[model samples]
Target: MLTRRTALLGATLALPAQAQERFPSRPVTLIVPGAPGGGGDFTARLLAEGLAGPLGQSVPVENRTGGSGNVAASFVARAAPDGYTLLLAYSGTHVANPALFRELAWHPIRSFAPVALLLTAPHVLVIRPDLPARDMAELAAYIRRNPGRVTYASSGVASIQHLGGAMLAQALGTEMVHVPYRGAGPAMSDIIAGRVDMIITTPPAVMGQIQTGAVRAIVQTGRARHPMLPNLPTTAEAGLPGFELEAWFGIYAPAGTPREAVLRLSRDIQGVTETAEFRRKAQEAGTYVTFLGPEELAAFTATELTRWSGIIQGLGIRLD
Candidate 1:
């Protein structure tokens, strides 16, 4: 008889299937939680271009910079879980922020659906050329000699760079002053000018300085040596065993987004990442494109969250 209650129930039951079938009927927005030209923005734009062809819709990148990625993250977290809106999440937003902040507007793991891991860039430890520390061992000795006097710069408070430096100091059983900057440019400039003793950042940010001899590469925070800086040994090899920190970028949809939509996006993104052109582009940017589907990404995110939360809590880091 098609009563009102029955009609409502039928419509409600049909929504998931209908939404999945007509998913992304319009343009999709990939939110970047950083200023344009930054690593997150670049990764978002690259993925948007690659995804448009596969998704059959224009994927546009929207930059919503603030609160160390909190602004955009909160926006996406509160967005409808319909797959049209997505986030280009990184270690800062998901792993570090959850540990650093007491009250984040969104849950790093629970508020979003993991789609895929797009790329990873190993953090490099760069120091002023005149610091006199030729290797990690020498650097450790130097820090020990002048404990608590050395200053390390980071893009901002609670950033991945800050966490990396904090972790290194903890491992070395020494203390160093942390200097927060507005952005990486100013921080890198200070490091080059010898105002800051060192900075732990990604390769692309400091590769030019290292190449021009303006700064020295002490060690990388990766399990393996970075191909671009083959001469630089990893922290594990350079005395800090088992210390590895690599910044990763991945895609995420708001939680409750249909499973079909999540899987479809992950599959297409995996294809995009495998293309030769995309690989070359990512390499040239000092990042490597690697694909991990939804389940693997979820597992990876869980592990990272647990790992960084402990590190951050142990270091007593907080950001309101």
Candidate 2:
């Protein structure tokens, strides 16, 4: 029974199985669900550079825009369960889209497995310099006086920008019109021209406008102030309690990906986030470097989903 031939046969059979355990035997692709030169694209590329050395494989970023980021989400959700194909998921696509669209091709929780959270930044509230509002209180009075005549611009109908504006109006017991534009650039342009009264958007999108005096930043929509905008007060500090909105970015793999591979990637990503160079770059981009492993990321996303769904339902705003 212990013959040399039997031993050789057993060893031969295990060769393929052992070979399959080595992940990253090939290059990895990180898919971005936004256009090039956008914030998401820039962050993805920065992460990709840091990940390549540690992963021992090139991590190329691929952008697939359109359909409100569904094009990229659907593609990643249907890709092979191996770690080779991954998604650079943003809060908008994963958190807001669930409530924005009545039907989605890919499910945030079911279609993909969380790998790691990259960073987080609270949205900034910007208004035209000519607006009489110096802060949220004055803005509320201005809105109450003008009613629906006070309009706010947003990147899209059900975007975070739009939802933030709605929340602000509800908190102030006032009403304001929403002007939906194709993108934040156009929305910012209109606001700078004083065509729109106000806008709520991510920090990076409004930093230039705020610095150049094109728009006045009344408050940041986070519990605490960010280092990038230390002079700006938080909503609670501005006397508007219970107003918080933080944007996050993370990595995800198609569902059913190997557990070991997911864990390995998470650890590798965390290493990159902790580097000094990465932190400096993220801070300069107006985002704080935040890292969450797989389980933590999943739980955080679940809580966000529940919170956003309630807000969306109460507002009765649904987009196809």
Candidate 3:
């Protein structure tokens, strides 16, 4: 026989314990900041499938695409920090957007808790099949000779592809007109059709074209050569030292999410990436699985923000 006051006190005392124990009692949602079947979406689904067993809950991926991931980033920023709502953050959203946009609705660093870094995929230098240049050296020389006449296409203004193109131009000390497109599909289509001179984009985006002889692969933009394209040299070996660049992906929960949950989710994600099946699948998906836990991911994000901000500022890129 307990009095009402006594019962209320007992319930209040148990609330914190209940909250602590109720983590992941239901399914978790991993928000992808891109359309379905895209890299982000593919990574999200892969992690979700692997995370369910360890987290003891169903992890589902939801695509919330628009505004270069702003819509999804904002939604995750405002979501309850119960560890249920997470974001599949990438270079464009977390690292590049802060510098590209004059004012973003949500601060990438402040609005989220870094969970883990999932993978990194390097870009490959490609040119039209009939382009006079045969390799990166020849391409650089050709651009030097052609000067402003040579053109490069990017997915859009301020995109990673654009930044890569800019960096390449800066490295070669050449002037090539930047042609922005709505998306990679259109840009790659134009590249295949010889509407653009060249494009430095991810292999997955143009691997089909390369295989079909629609475009020629010249070099890869990574410290080391990609295993899939062992014959191709890296940018450093291709005569552009210090020209390495790769797009990375990570996971994050909204700021103020439980510290315990963040650590738990980070550990689970690391475990997911360590599995043999996951590694093989990641290789198949054209990305190498690299796991960085919360602390490492946070530091990595900070460094990336700084690096890309410097690059964007140097390039004088701004989107309001």
Taken over the whole model, the C-alpha lDDT of each candidate is 0.85, 0.85, 0.83
Determine which window of 10 residues in candidate 1 has minimal summed lDDT: 15-24
**lDDT of model 3, residue 246:** 90
Better of 1 and 3 by TM-score: 3
Please state every model's RMSD to the true fold in angstroms: 4.3, 3.3, 3.2
Per-residue C-alpha lDDT of model 3 across residues 1-320, encoded as one tens digit per residue? 99999999898888876474667788999997766544566678889999999999999888776676787899999998889999998686678988888788888789999999998988888898889988887888899998888888876667788888888888888778989765566678888888998887766567667777899999998889777778889988988888888988899999999899999999889999999998987876567998998888889998999999998898777788
Window of ten residues with lowest summed lDDT in model 2: 34-43
How far residue 259's Cα lies from its native spot in candidate 2, in Å, is: 2.1
In the range 185-249, model 1's lDDT, one tens digit per residue, is: 67888889999999988776777788899999999988888667788898888888888888989
Q: Order of all candidates by TM-score, from best down to worst? A: 3, 2, 1
By lDDT, rank the candidates, best first: 1, 2, 3
For model 2, name the residue pairs that clash.
Answer: none
Error of 1 at 276 (Å): 0.9
Q: Per the 3 Å backbone cut-off, how many clashing residue pairs does candidate 3 have?
A: 0
Scored by TM-score, the top model is: 3
Q: What is the lDDT of residue 59 in candidate 3?
A: 91
Cα displacement (Å) at residue 243, model 3: 1.1
TM for every model, in the order presented, reads: 0.84, 0.85, 0.86
